[model samples]
Target: MNTQALGVEYYLAGMRAALDDLPPNEVAEIMEDVEAHVAELSTELGENETLEQRLGSPEQYAQELRQAAGYPPRTERLPVTTKKQLVTRPRVAAWGLAIATAVTLLAGTAVLRQSAILLLPAVLLVLSLALVHDRGPAQQEIMDLPETRKIQQWLTPEEGTPGERALTYLKSLQPAWWLARAGLLGLGAVLLASRDILGFLFIAGIAVLSVFAGPRAKVDRRWLWFSLPASALAIGLLFQVIDVTANNLAYSSSRQVYQPPAMQSYENIYAYDENGKLLTNVLLYDQDGNPINAPRQYYGCNGDDPQPMIPANRYPRPKIDYENGSCYTVAPSVVAPSSTESAPPSSSGSAPSNSVAPTSVSPSK
Candidate 1:
């Protein structure tokens, strides 16, 4: 290769490594621009003049490019001692709290039925906020540390790997997740508020705040204190709703399986004769020749003194208070009998006088 060609290749190689942390498309564009600029400069170079003399080192050129592009300055790799000092105790504690918060939040979701589990994540989140506050301006330095940069790089997805693809997919879903988080927070507010209108409005306002905070937190790390806890609470509420819904469905299924259709909501049966006089001890039977007894075990006046009645095929049963040894008839409503009601002749060919029989019955609770 010619001297100029070798110089260009060496410069390009160093530039590529220096800009490795940038997006691939951005790096490619930068390289193209630099290559063209170098070619133009080479034609104007005098004898004994080198590319390094005109453009400085490749790292310096890359730095100027980053500044022109409005990208943050590239962080250089730190020596072992500097790296150790950069990983301050406060930063380490803050990261630990963050991890603990995530773990507890996930565990809380798994055991949403046990609401107490939510407390741990909440406590961890508080600790994280406190640590961030204590770190103050130094927090920025901690974030810029080599270890932190390495973690960020690892988290950023690259092409052609399953884990990377998964991470990319998750990142793509962030906007949708933000909206869902708001909805979850609103739903949780409704549940916690129950019937209190003012309380629901107050909590719903927080959910609305989350809607704005969620997107803002992505661009500004300072918003994380509010966004992180809000998101965790929203997740907890979502899982709690799921847990409650599941339990209710299970209970409803069991009730449907075990309870007889006719006996549901049944409390008492009232019988009346044609003259509107309440009937007593009126026997009841089904078309299949089976006796229809009361479904529940106990009946009483106003449910004050409940006492079991002997299971039998009888309507208009009396309420017995065993404690006071008293019996009273349950008269829910009165109905007038038809004026044309008449008795049929007896077996002896004589009509009975003033004889009545229950003609209809109704159940009530």
Candidate 2:
């Protein structure tokens, strides 16, 4: 190739690399337009005038095209020597702080559950936000970062590679993930609020905001301020829910025997007859002929002198104030018992006339 042709080819190669992030078809069309333009310019160039003198560097040319086409400005890859210098840039530092804050907040709140450790991330987040606001226009600087490019290259690997396939699969699931994130956020809110309606609504609003902001944040960095914190809180709440569920399951499994629902709260059983008279020494049984048991081993007292009552189906047990050395009988109403009679044994399977049924009373009541 002649000198002019070689210059054109070299320019196009540089422009191609600059626009690597664009779609292949779009890149091809852009290259064709630039090639035709450069050919015309090469013909008009004097002997000593180069394409770089006429059109500036290929990176600069590509940037002009991007601006004209209403595309975001591309970040040209910098050499390894300049990477350290770029890391100290305010925009790059802000992004680094933002990432560190997110990771620390998530780990501290959800995994570590340590409030003392969370102060650092909180301060970092505030500093990150301040830097982002002050630095202005961080998207280009962030994209130009060495770490960012490495991540992009890793995610967008060579075709047919396992990384590429995995990336493709993950990209396909993006819509589903977006929906799941909102749902999970709402669920976490509900769990954290103990199923309160107001809490659900508040988190649900944040979830909705996140769903919309998540996509926009890719193009617009400002949305990060809202989206990041909301996501962190959602993830923390989800972990909290998981921890609570696991604890409940462990507690339930530790108990060898199941306690009946009716006996869960009440410790003593009381029996009453049809005439509103209290019945004493009444034995109770279930339909299956099983003795209905009470919850506690001792009853009828409140202190160290608690009366040891045998575990039986007896009802209308006396209430005793051990401190006062007094035992008192309880009735359903002001009416006294007709007599101190031992009622006949009763079964839940069949109700007999004058058969007194055992009733449970909670300790608080």
Candidate 3:
């Protein structure tokens, strides 16, 4: 019990320490004794005076009780530091704490933007801290310091701290910050080869923007202008890469002869269906022993052009019919020739009425 200074805080602290070991019954007895003392004092003062005034002061009363109990006076004990004092904030301290807490909350929210689970505690903590820090110190002694000559200035009609002003400034830039974040995400997806790296960059961008939403961060970067558009452009270029790779693979597999391709005409063109794109020009070949030419594409065939041309380019002589109705190409086997030898003499027989196979040749008698 080192109560070097006797103050209100020390007086209560001493009592609390004594009560820690004392039973509930003992505490009740102490209370009753104090009440009895006050009552007696009240009676002596002739009911006109309050019991409080007759008792001198609460501290003095407690001191006398200590003497009567064979305990040292509360003033002779050391000061008892409390959790209350530790947590309590001075005016300036409160403002600084508020700014730091606000910044922390914003930073946390930004970091956890993708995860709702993480953002809640950070937000709750910020609000709680702000509520507490916004209040001035519990006790203030007024002095005639020139308001204008004060070391610090506030940004409002009412009074505030530089941190509050900073917070307000930060709040104003949130929209831009968010835009930048989305832009940076795109940029990262472009620049980062690994998926994990890209994901981290995306989260970082979100955090940066989220912090900007609070009243604590400063933003004055020039290169910030290109962040979003450049990211989008990069993403678009990736689409092109996918497209080229897909086309290359498609071309390699196009050699399968079993699956027929979309119909084409004289000048080569790609064909399409209602649903989507189709494989085109699978049986590529040309007449007169030449490489196939690009064929024209048509979705529908007119009455004059009923049967669409399917090139049967397997045989020799490479005959390709351009007739309107004949869906024609050369057969796969032998080639026909322009020149022919003379036919040998033959005997003719009359056709039978019901004989399915009646054609016969006999030597003339």
Please name the candidate that would achieve the greatest TM-score relative to the true structure: 2
Each prediction's TM-score versus the true structure: 0.45, 0.46, 0.23
Better of 1 and 2 by TM-score: 2
Encode model 1's per-residue lDDT on 93-157: one tens digit a residue: 55755676576557536432343454566566676666555433224434554677688789975
> Which one wins on lDDT?
1
Question: Which regions in candidate 2 have their CA more than 4 angstroms from the true location?
Answer: 1-55, 58-123, 133-138, 194-205, 257-365
Off by over 4 Å in 1: 1-93, 96-100, 103-127, 133-151, 195-205, 260-365
Off by over 4 Å in 3: 1-55, 65-97, 113-302, 311-365
Candidate 1: residue 329 Cα off by (Å): 24
lDDT of each: 0.61, 0.60, 0.38
Candidate 3's TM-score? 0.23
lDDT, model 1, position 288: 95
lDDT of 3 by residue, 1-365 (tens): 22333333334333445442443344444644554455465457643454445544555665566677775444423335522244433333334333444443344323322323324433544444444332222111011112322533443424376777776887688666555545544443443434455445544554455434322222221112122222332344345445556988887788564566544322322233333323334454556666554323222223444233445321122223333533233322221222233121111211111211111111111
